[model samples]
Target: MTVALMWEARAADGRGAELLAWVRRQDLAPAPLRRETFRAPQDRVLVITWWDAPYDAALPELPDPPAESVTRAVHRWRFEAVTDH
Candidate 1:
């Protein structure tokens, strides 16, 4: 099975660039099959990682940034691929 993990966060005030840099510096042990990063108008940063594993399997994910770097807690989600269609 294939699993995708989504991680999103909003940077504090005008610290979007700093937050993005911090996210890019993170390293995932046993890296995923694929990974991507994105940013939005509201200083929001998003990261998605694809892995070859069971839906319920424990997977590596980006951790939250330092308290002063973000406006709130990070958001995360996990989904299994639906390729039957």
Candidate 2:
């Protein structure tokens, strides 16, 4: 089975680019089968990583970005993936 890790953050005003760059440099432990990022309105950043593991398996996570770049605390979520195709 594959598990997905979802990480999200809201950047402080005018800091979305910096926040996105910081997150882009992060290393994913155990290596993900796939990964992607998205930018949303209101300076939001979303990162999704798909790992080759059981739904209940433990996975590495990206650390929080610098305080100066974010408006609020970061949020994280884990999901057991269903069929992708």
Candidate 3:
């Protein structure tokens, strides 16, 4: 089975670059099979990590950034791949 974890956050005013840099510096002990990052117009940063594990298996996820770096709590979601694409 394959699972994808999504994490999104909106940075504090004028701190988008800082937030993105912070996310880039994070390291996962047991890295995911694949990982990607993106940014949006509203100073939002998104990270998605793919893992070769069951949907309900324990997985490592990125932790929240420092309080002052974000406007609010981060958002996260998990999905299990249903196709071989």
TM-score order of candidates, top first: 1, 3, 2
Q: Rate the local accuracy (lDDT) of all candidates.
A: 0.95, 0.91, 0.96
Model 1, span 32-60: residue lDDT tens: 99999999998999999999999999887
| Candidate of highest lDDT | 3
Runs with alpha carbons beyond 4 Å of true place in candidate 3: none
List clashing residue pairs in candidate 2. none
Candidate 2 residue-wise lDDT, 1-85, digit = tens: 8888999999999999988898999988678999999999999999999988888887899898989889989999999868768
Return the clash pairs for model 3, or none.
Answer: none
Candidate 3 local lDDT, 1-85, one digit each (tens): 9899999999999999999999999988699999999999889999999999999989999999999999999999999989656
TM-score of each: 0.97, 0.91, 0.96
